[model samples]
Structure formats: structure tokens, C-alpha cells
Target chain A: MLEFLERIGWFVGLVLVQVLVLSHVHIYGYATPFLYIFFVLSLNSGIDRNILLIWAFAIGLTVDIFCNTPGMHTAAITLVAFLRQPILKGVVIKEVEEEFEPCISTMGFFPYLKYTLLCTLIFCSVVEMIDTFSFFDLKELGLKIITDTLITLVCIFCVEAVFRRDKSEERF
Target chain B: MRNLLDFLIKYKHWLLFIFLEVISFVLLFRFNGYQGSVFFTSANVVTGKVYQMTNNLTGYFHLKTINSDLVQHNAELSIQLEHLKEAYKKLTADTTVIEQMKQEALMDCRLIKANVINNSTIHANNFITIDKGEADGVQKEMGVVSGSGIVGIVYQTSAHYAVIIPVLNSKSSISCKIRRSDYFGFLKWEGGSPEFAYIKDMPRHSIFEVGDTIVTSGHSAIFPSGVLVGTVDDVGDSNDGLSYSIRVKLFTDFARLNEVRVIERSNIEEQLELEESVVNKER
Candidate 1:
């Protein structure tokens, strides 16, 4: 019950931070770090995939509502949630524990970093591609996707570091 | 049936994913297909309120700049007022024609002040939201202009806010003319830099040069005659080469725009009715 409330709190907090704060940060007129993806990324592996997908869609739509981007956010985030399992399967874990949440402290530094990097890249690509919606400015789209992905990764890393939990706090 | 039910249960997540994606795609296509659908747009009540609140917070930061702009405009208006008084005195002393003064008073437009609450320039179809709306006497299709120059026409309005299809949008084409000559063209914003726009359909023989001033022609009742639009920075041949397309540097710096006035042209319906009657008679 406490965990559920915490998840709810984290979701709202991330959305507020994303819409009010991060959306204003337009660096070099290209990248806007979508740190709200951290909410999706930090969900426990033990959580039901169905719930995860729903949560992802809801959060993405919420972000869209704030930014006035109709369906772009929902589409990109739903893509990430759909592919999260496939991506996770490819990442080999030596000692898999039940209900282990993926974080730098829980999953080790490099593995967690790789996980976030892959998710952010895929998410950012879908967003920028759908936004431009044509190949006319592929160069601009590519630059925006890459820059935004890197900046989002950096932001997510900082957030994870600040909110890092001790091993005792792990669910399993 | 039991086997099918089991299969459905097993692949429920995949089904859910596909369903959500299809919904998102529907929304995407629906919105992009229709340019001015205000239902899901930021001009909606809830989002409009949030943007207004955010603008209220951030507007304070721009107070000094806005004040300076207002002061400059006031000085210019005062000088124009003085000139107008001198002209009136000279005309009265010479001919005693009250008809000229009455004709000048016949201008039916009124300016309502408003602040831009939200705006976007990155999109091909950019929109600007102003603080005034229906309750504030702002109606759809009304012209919005900054102190510097033409901004756009009102696209949609809620109870408390209104959205503008500004000069940056591809759909925006304002009738404008050369200040020196009667040669006219339609101003168009092709994708790219926001500082520049193109004026197409000017005749090849039209007498024009770089640095020529362009202003609203008053051909469309949206904007009155001689409102400062832009200045021709480059003169080039049109795509067909039969006519000329002039690149203009717009007077209004949209990136720095904070305040504007919504032009309410009174008696537009009566004029439209008269024009419609003339068209009917011609037919």
C-alpha cells in the first residue's frame, strides 16, 4: 500500500517537474530533456506488464496535456513500454532476483546505465520523428533525437543518484 | 472457445499495446489533418488556465522591456497627434470643410489591449494565445497586431483566452503592398527562419527595390491601410519567373512579443452585406 502511494506521488511529482521546469529548458534550440521517463524506467520489474503499459500511457498523455502535444508523447511512451520487455531480455543478468527494481544501486552502475540509454534513445527517436512527420528535415530530426536522448540520459542519471535507495529498501 | 479465451488472456498485454497505439495514431491524424481543431488544443480551458498562470508568473520578468516599448509607442503617438492637430487647424483655416473631419471619424475599428500568454515558433503551424477572450470582447477572425506591426488573426477563443494563427503559420497570408507604390502581394511564411517571410504575386514590372517598405493594403478589412508590415530585404524572381517574390524583414519581433492589441472593426457585417449585394447585382 505504501509502495503504491509512493508510486503515485513519484508520478505526480515527475509530471509537475517535467511540464513546469524541464519544458522551459530549451538548450541550443534543440534538446528538451524529458526527465518524466524516469518514472516509467524506475517501476519494479515484478509489477504487472499490463499495469506498466497503462501507467506509461497515462503518464505520457499527462505530459502531452501540459505541453499541448496531442498524441506525440503518448505514442512514444507507449512504444517504450511495449518494447521494454524485449529490450530487457537481451540484457543478460548474472544473478536475477525476484521483484528486483532496476536502478544504479540495485542493478549495478553499467547495466542500469545501458538500460536507460537504450530506452531514452528509442523514446526520443519516436517523439522527434513523429513530431517532424516527414523525411524533409531528417538531419534536424536526427540531431534533435540524439541531443535530447543524451541530455535526458544525463538528467535521469542525476535524478537516480539523488533518489538512490539502500540495498535494504529493495523489495526482494 | 476455451482455447480462444486462454489465448486472449495470454496476449492481453500485446492487445493493450496495439489498442493504445491505434488510439494515439487516431488522435495524431485527427489533429494534424485539421489545422484549427481547438478541442484538444492548448486553447482549451484547463490548459489555457495553466498557461495563463505561468505567463502571469513570467510576465513580471519582462516588465522593464514592455514598459520601454510602451513609452516609445506613447512618444510616437504624441508626435502623430500633434501633426494631426496642425493638419486639422490648417484645413479649417483654409476651406472650412467639416466633411474631412467627419470622414476621418468614420474609422470603425477599436483596439483592445492584451498580453500573449503562450506562443510557439518551432512548428510549421505556429499559434499564439492571448490573455483576452470572448468576455474581453475578443472574437474569432479579429486582427491582432503588436505595436511594431501585424501579428495575426484570431483563430479560436474560449471564455478567457484566445488563440492566434500568427504571421509565422503557413496558413497565414496577409494582403500587403509596397509603401511607395500600389504594387501589392500576399505575405507567406515558408518554413525556416522566423525573422523573414516572402511576398509573392507582385508583377515583374512593379517598381520595387531592396529596403522598400511594405504595409497592409487594407484590401482585406482585417487590417486597416498603411499598418507597418515589413520591409523588402531581398527582391527575387518568382518560381515561374513571370512575377517577383520579395523577401521581407517583418517589423514585429515575434520572439520578443509580449503585448498586442486586438482590432475590433465595428460595422463589418453591414459592409459585408453591402458588398454581397453588389456581387449579387453583378451576377
Candidate 2:
């Protein structure tokens, strides 16, 4: 119950930050980091797949409501949620615990980095594709997808590092 | 029946995923047709309230720049007032005619002041949410303009908030003409930059220079004639090779937009009615 409440808190916090603060940051006129995806990225691996999809749909729809782009985020984030389990299985080593959440400390830095990079790339590409809905400006679309992925990846890593420090301190 | 039930349970997650994706796409495609729903948009009560609170905090940071802009505008207005006074004295011979024209212009429309609560330019179909809506006389298709120049037309409105489809959106097409030559075209944003838009369908024989000013042609009822749009930045041939596509540098800095006024055209319904009557007569 307490874990559920904490998850809910993180959901609200991330959505607010994404909508109010990060959404306004258009770095170099191309990159707008979508850090809200970090919530789904940090969920426990053992969680039910159906529940995970529902959570992703909720988050994406919330963002869509705020940003006035209905279903654009919904479709992208839903696909990410559906693919998360397979991607995690492929990336992580075999010895990890079933209920363990994927983070830098648990999955090791390189594997975690690879996992995040792949997920962010997929999320950004889907989002940019839906936004433009056409390959007419392939150069611009490619630039946006790359920049958004890099910026969002950097943000996710920074957030993970902060939480990782907190968990490590609790161990001491 | 047993086998069917077992299969359904076996791949329930996959089925759920596909179902959700199909629903999402439905919402995506249907959104353009029914964009006025308040629940799915930022103009809804919850989103509007949150944005209003944030704007209050962020509004302070822009005060310095807004003040300077206001001061410059005030100075320019004072100069114009002085020139108008001189012109009024010289035109006293035709004073009745000038007064009649002034009254007619004033009677055509009124301005309703509002603040932009939320705005975005990064998306291909950018939208702006304002603090005023139906309660404040704002309605769909009304022209929205900032102090500097044209902002956009109102797309939707709720009880106390409204959404504007700014010039940055691909769906937005405003009628504009070159100020010097009066040759007109449909201004469109092909996505990528907020600062520039392309004016399509200008006649091939139209003569316009790079620095020529563009303004609303007033061919439509939304904006009155001669509202400042932008200045011509470049000229190129349209894809069909029959007309010119001129690039315009927009005057309103949408990135810094704060306050705006919704033009309430008093005669809009009457004019629309008259036009419809003419069409019906022809039919």
C-alpha cells in the first residue's frame, strides 16, 4: 500500500514537472526533454503487464490533456509500456531478482544506460513521428528525434543518480 | 468454449495492448474534428487553473521587458496622436466625412482584454490558452491580436477559458496581402519555425520587394483591414509554378506573448447572414 502511494506521488510529481517546467525548455530550438517517461522506466520489473499498460496510458493521457495533443503521447507511451518487459529481459543479465527494479545500481551502469538509450530513442521517435505525421521534412524530423532523445536520456540519468544516492545512504 | 476461454486468458495482455493502441489512434484522428471538447484540452478548468497559477509566478520575470515595450508603444502612440491632431485641423473642411468614417470603424468591433495563460510553439500544431472565454464575450473564429500585431483566431472556448490556433499551427491559414501592392495570398506555416511563415497563391505578376509589409487583407470578417501581420523576408515560386510563395517574418513574437485582445466584431453575424442570403438567391 505504501509503495503504491509512493508510486502515485511520483506520477503526479513527474507529470507536473513535465507540463509546467520541462515542457517550456526548448533547448537549441529542437530539444524538449520528456522526463515524465522516467516513472514507467523505474517501475518494478515484476509488475503485471496489464497494470503497467494502464499506468502508462494514464500518464500519457494526463500529459495529452495538459499539452492539448490528444492521443499523440498516449499512443507513444502505450507502445513503450508494452515493449518494456521484452526490452528489460533482453538487456538485463539472468541473475537479477524477479521483483528488482532496473536502475544503475541493480543493472550496472552500462546495461542501464543501454536500456535507457533504447527506450528513449523509441519514445522520441514515436512522438516526433506522430507530431509531424509525415516524412516530408526528414532532416528536421531526424534532428528533433535525436536531440529529444539525448536530452531526455540525460535528464533520466540525472534523476536516477539522485535517487540512487538516497537508496545507498539508507543502506548505511 | 473451454479452448477459446483458455486462449483469451493466455494472450490477454497482448489483446489489451492492441485495444489501447487502437483507442489511442481513434482519439488522435478524431481530435481534429471535435477539438472543442473542454475535457481533453488545456482550457479545461483543471489545466487552466494550474496554468493561471504558474503564469502568476512567471509573469513577474517578464515585467521588465513588458514595461519597456509599453513605454516604446506609448511614445509611438503619442507621436501618432500629434500627427493625427495636425491632420484633423487640416481636414476640418471634410470634418463630417472623417467623423463618419471614424464612427463607422469604431462601431464595427470592440476589443476584449485577456492574458495568455498557456502557450506553446514547439509542436507542429501549436495552441495558446487564454484566460477569457465565453463569459468574457470570446467565441470561436474571433480574431486575437497582441499589442504589436496579429496573434491568431480563437479555436474553442469554455466558460472561462479559450484556445487559440496561433499562426504557428499547420491548420492555421490567414488571408494576408502585401501592404504596398495589395496583392493577397493565404499565409501558412509549414512547421519548423515560429518566426517565419509562407504566403501562398500570390499572383505571378504581383510586385513585392523583400522588405514589403504584409497585413490582413480584411477579405474575411474576423480581422479588420490593415492589421499588421509581418514583413516579407523572401520570395519563391509555388510548387505548381503558377503563383509566388513569399516568406514573411511575423511581427508578433509568439515566444514572448503575454497579453492579447479578442476582437468582438459586432457586425459579423449580419455580414455572414447577408452573404448567405446572396448565395441562397443565386441557388
Candidate 3:
């Protein structure tokens, strides 16, 4: 119960930081890193594909409502949440996977970094691309993808670095 | 029956997720004009108490600004009172020419305070998360403008939070007309630049000049007429004759956006009812 409440608190905090502080941050004309995905990432490994999709849908829909997309984020987040299992299956070896949640610390040093970087980069790119609908020129599309991916990667790296934690600290 | 059971067994989780999402979509389509009021409106004691706490938090921040505005307003009122007294005495001695200022005096604007929670800017169609939700008095189609300028529209609201689609996103388009010529066009983001959006469907015959102001046309219920949208940067005609491609520099700096106002018309219900009746009669 405490852990559940703790997760809720964490979600709330991410939301606040995203809106109050992060929303104000723009790099090279692109703003908002969408670190809120961390909420879904932080969920335990045993989560079912169905529940994860719903969670992603709920979260995405929540974001969608706030942003007013026709169902864009919902579609993207749902895709990633559905894809999370397969992606993790490829990245996390069976032995280390038992030890921790999916992040730089839990999945082991190098594996965690690789996993977080790859997952977040993919997630942000796909969401942004879908949201934009492969607009006018290929150059603009490429630029948006690269820029979005870079910011997302850098953000994840910085956040993971600053809030350095060991596997044991997360399991609560 | 057997096939149905098999399908259900195969995709129960997907079905469940779809069910919730459909519910969300329904809420989005159903509500209009200030869903935030619903939370504060409910007679339920629990919701009322929760809103009270949230309102208290908002009040703590708003007091100083509100107080200063009232103080200046009070000073203005005192001067007006003296003038009114003098006018009262003159009514018996002279003809009164002061016509009642009704429409122009009531410039409709309301400030809605909502906490920012989950927001995305990188997405092609971005969303802003606010602590205010359906229960608070926010509704879909109500204009969401930040301190900077026109922000976006309220898309969805839960019990405690609402989302806005900012102008930077491609999906948002409002009918805007050049202030100088009064020639109208549709303003849409091309999703290329943050500072610019394209105005489509303007004919080549129309004039296109630099630094012309653009404002919303009150053609739709979304915004009142003459809300400052942006300025025309450049205009070009297409090879074909359909429309001109004009670029606009948006007035709102979406990057620095915070705090928005939701504009609700007083006669929205009447307008909606009249439209619905017309449609029904046509049917």
C-alpha cells in the first residue's frame, strides 16, 4: 500500500516538474522532454502486457487530454508500452533481470545505461513523429526526429546520473 | 458463441484497455465549455472539500495580484463616483447625452488557475497538463490562452486535471483575418518552425504585406472575435489557383507559456440549443 502511494507521489512529482520547471525549458526551439514516461518505466517487471497497454493508454490519454491531440499520444504510448516487453526481452539477460527494475542501476551498470538510452530515445522519437504526421519535407522530419531523440537521451542520461540509485533502493 | 469466447480469451486485456480509452474519448466528445466547473459544482461533500483545498492553494498565490488590481480599481471608482454625483445634479438642469455603455464595457475574459502536471512539447501535437479538470470548470472548445497570448484549446479533463493543445502543435487551426483588409484566412501550423504558422486558402487576388496584424474571427464558438492571434510575415501564391500560402509570426511565445484563461460565452447554452433545434428541424 505504501509503495503504491509512493508511486502515485512520484507520478505527481514528475507531473509538477514537467509542467512548472521542464515545460519552461526549450533547447533549439524544441521544449518538453516527456520524462513522465519514467512513471511507466518504473513499474515492476511482472506487469502484464494488457495492463501496461492500459496504463500507457491512460497516461497517454491523460497527456492527450491535457494537450488536445485527437488520440495521437494515446496511440504512441500504447505502442511503446506494448513494445516494452519485447524490447526488454532483447536487452535484459535473465540473470540480471531478476535483480532489479528496468533502469541503469537495476539492470546492471552498462546494461542499464544502454537500455534507458535506447528505450527513451525510441519512445520520444516515435511519439513525436506520429504526433507530427511525417510533415512537409524529409529534412524537417529528420531534424525533428534527431532533435527529439537527442533531447530525450540527454534528459534520461542526466536524470539517471543525478538521481543515482542502486537496485535495492527501487524495489519498495 | 464459441468463436466469441475464443476471441475474448485471446484479447481480454486489449479489450479492457480499449474499453477505458473509449470511455475517455466519450468524455472528451461529450463535454463543452468549462468542465472545471463540474468539480466545484457537485453537491458531493468530498469533491467540494477537495476543491476547497486546491482553491486555497491557488488563493494564496492570487491574493497579492488581486489586491493590487482592486486597489487601483477602487481609486478609479472614487473618481467616477464624484463625476456621477455632478451628473445627477445636472440632469435637472441640462440634457443628458451619455449613452449606456453595454457591449463594449463588458469585455469578456476570465482567468483560470490550474497547476501544470504532465505536458509534452516535442510531440508534433503537444499537450499541456493542468491541475484543473472537468470538475474545476474547464471544458473542451474553450480557448486556453496563457499569459503570453493564445495558447490552445481544452482537449480533455479528468476529475482533477485537464489538458490543453498549444498553438505550436499542427492540429490546431483557427480562422484568422488580416486586421488591415479584413480578408479572412485559416491559420495552421506547418510543424516546421515554432515561431511560424501558415495561413491557407487566401486567394492570390488578395494583398499580402509584411507586419500585418491577424486576429481570430468569431465565426466559431471557440473564441470571441478580435483575439490577437499573430502577424502576417510573408505571402506567396501557389502555382495552381486554389489558395495563397502565407506565413504568420505567432503572437504567443509558447515556450514561456504559463497560466491560461478559459473564455466561456454567457449565452452558449442558448446558442447550442438553437443550433440543435435547427438541425433537428432540418432532419
Candidate 4:
């Protein structure tokens, strides 16, 4: 019960930060890093795919409401959520087929970084592409995608470090 | 039937994904406008409250600059007031001229002050949210201007908050012209620096130079005539090479936008009705 509540709190916290704070930070006038994908990344692997999709939709809608982008965030984040399982399967090793969260502690450092980077790339590309909704300027879109993905990856790396539990600090 | 049920169960997640994406696409294409349903937009109550809270937290940092700006504007207003008083006294001596001026004053508008609660300048289609809303007489199509220059048009308004599609958005286009020669162009932002926007479709023969001033042409009912927009920084040929596409340095620093005045034209409805009648007659 406590774990469930903690997870819910973390989700809300991320959405709040993304909407109220990070959305306002447009680094160098183009790269607005969206770090809320960390919520989708940190969810337990055992959770149902259907449930995951709903959660993704909910977070995306929350962000879209604040940013006034209508359905763009929803479409992009839902794509990330939908692609999460397949991407995870492709990245993870066969031996560690357990139902742990995709944090640095659960997945080894290299595998976790790879997983986060791939997901961030997919999510950022979807978002930037849908934002234009047309082939207006491919170069600008490419710049936005690459820069935003890199920024989001840096944020996710910071989050991974912050959330990593020390052995002495672990309750178990 | 059993096989169908089994298939349905197997593909439920995929179905859900498709369902959500469909809803998103519908919202994207259908309700993307500022006048679209404001229920899901930032102008809505819950989101508005969140943005307002964040604004309150960050607003304190901008107090020094905002105060100085207010003082400067106050001084300018006092000077204008003195000039207007002298003009009024002179005009009153000529009753016929005073009557004509009064008749023109009937078309005068009012300004409602609002603070910028949230703004984004980096997106291709950026939006700005202000603290004023429908209750504050802020309606869609109303012009928003800072003390410096025109800010944007009020796109959506809720009971207590409103969102503006500023000059920074790629989707934004405001009708403006050269102040010296009345050669008009449509001002558009092509997404680089927020400080500059491009004016398209200026006549190739029109003579212009850098530092030339551009102001609203009043062709659109949204903004008044001769309102300052920007100054020409660079002039170049349009993509088709037929017309001039001039770059303008906007006066409103959208990043430092703290307050704005929403302009409400008193006879807008009547003017729109008249225009509509003309179109109807032509059709």
C-alpha cells in the first residue's frame, strides 16, 4: 500500500515539476527538455500494459493542459509508453528477465543508460515532429529533437542518481 | 464467438493505445484553436491555478524592473495627459471641430490591465497565459499590448485566466506596414530568435532600409492603426524571389513580459456585423 502511494506521489510530483517549472525553461530558445518521461521509465515492469497506457495518457494530458499544446504531448508520451515494453525487451539481457523497475540499481549501468537514451530519443522525436505537424523545416526539427533528447537524458541521469538507494539506507 | 473474445482479450492493450492516440489526434486537429474548448487548455481553472502559483513564486524576482517600467510609463502618461488637456481647451474654443472629435471618440476603446502569468517563447506555436480572463472583459480577438508595443491577441479566455498566441508563434501573423511609406506586409515568426520576426509580401518596388519602423495597418479589426510593432533589421527577397521578406526587431521582449493591457474595441460587434453584411451582399 505504501509503495503504491509512493509511486502515485512520484508521478504527481514529476507532472507538477514538468508543467509548472520545466515547461518554462526554454534553453537557448529551442530545447525545452521534458523530464516527465522518467515516470514512465520508472514504473514496475510487472504492471499491465493497458494500465501503463492509461497512466501515460493521464500524465500527458496533465502536461498538455498546462502547456496549451492540446493533444501533442498526449500523442508523444503515449507513443513512448506503448513502445516501452518492446524497447525494454530489445535492450535488456536474457538472464535478467525479472520484474524490477528500470533504474540503475535494477538494470546494470550501461543497459539502463542505453534504455533511457533510446526512450528519450523516441519520445523527443515524436514530440518535435508532432509539434510542427508538417514538413515545414526538417533541419530545425532535427536540431530540436537532438538537443531536447540530450537534455532529457541528462535530466534522467540526474534522477537516476538521486533515486539510487544506498545499501545502508535500504529498509530491508 | 469464443475465438473473437480471446482475440479481443489478447489485443486489449493495443486497442487501448489506439484509442488514446485517436483521442489525441482529435483534440489536436479539432480543439487546437485558442477559441476551442478551454476546458482542457491552460486557461482552465485547475491548470490556471497551478500556473498562477508558479507565477507568484517567480514574479517577485522581476519586481525591480517592473517598478521602473511602471514609473517610466507613468511619467509618459502624465505628459500625454497635459498635452491632451491643452488640446481640449484649444478645441473647445472651436465647437464645430470639438463636435467632430466627440463623434470620433464614440469609437474609442477601453484597456484592461493584466499580468503575464505564464509564457513560452521557444516553441513553433508558443502561447502566453495572462491573469485576466473573460470576467475581466478579455474576449477572443482582443489585442494585447505591453507598454513597449503590441504583445499578441487573446486567443482563449476562461472565467479568470486567458491565453494569448503571441507574435513569437509561427502560426501567428499580424498585418503591419512601413510607418514612412504604408507598404504593408504580414509579420510572421520563422522560429529562431524570439526578438525578431519576418514580414512577408512587401512589394518588391517598395523602398525600405534597416531601422525603418513597422506599425499595425489597422486592416484587421484586432489592432488599432499606427500601433508600434517593430523596426526593420534586415530585408531580403521572399522564398519565391518576387517580394521582400523583411526581418523586424520586435519591441516587446516576450521573455520579460510581466504586464499587458487587453484592448477592447467598443463597437467591434457592430463593425463585424457591417463587414459581414458587405460580404453577404457580395456573395
- Candidate with the greatest DockQ versus the true structure: 2
Single out the weakest 10-residue window by summed lDDT for candidate 3 chain B: B36-45
Expressed as tens digits, the lDDT of each residue in A1-172 for candidate 1 is 9989999999999987887778767676678899999888888877788999999999998877656567888999999988887676566367475667778766778888788999999999998887666324878888989999999999998877767654435544
Q: What is residue B36's positional error in candidate 1, in angstroms? A: 5.7
For candidate 2, give the lDDT of residue B92: 84
| Reference-based lDDT, each prediction | 0.84, 0.92, 0.64, 0.87
Give model 4's docking category. Answer: medium
Candidate 2 chain A weakest ten by summed lDDT = A93-102
lDDT of 2 at B200: 79
- A1-172: candidate 2 lDDT, tens digit per residue: 9999999999999999999999889987889999999999999999999999999999999999999998999999999999999899889867666588888877889889989998899999999999987325888889999999999999998999887779967878
Candidate 2 wrongly placed segments (more than 4 Å): B34-36, B93-98, B277-283
Predictions' DockQ, in order: 0.53, 0.76, 0.28, 0.73
Q: For model 2, what is the alpha-carbon lDDT of residue B233?
A: 96
TM-score of 4: 0.92
Question: What TM-score does each of the candidates earn?
Answer: 0.87, 0.97, 0.62, 0.92
Off by over 4 Å in 1: A95-97, A165-172, B1-3, B35-39, B91-106, B240-242, B270-283
| Candidate 3 local lDDT, B1-283, one digit each (tens) | 9999999999887786677556544544343233432322212234333434554564466567656755886888899989986976677544343333333435454556764444455545565656676677777777876544477777655566666766766667788787788888777776656788888788767765889888887676777778888888887764475888788898776644445677766656666788889999999
User: Candidate 4, B143: how far from true, in Å?
Assistant: 0.9
RMSD per model, one decimal: 3.4, 1.6, 7.5, 2.7
lDDT of 4 by residue, B127-219 (tens): 999999988889998999998998999888889999898998877889999999999989988877889999979999998889999999988
Interface RMSD list for the candidates: 2.2, 1.3, 6.7, 1.6
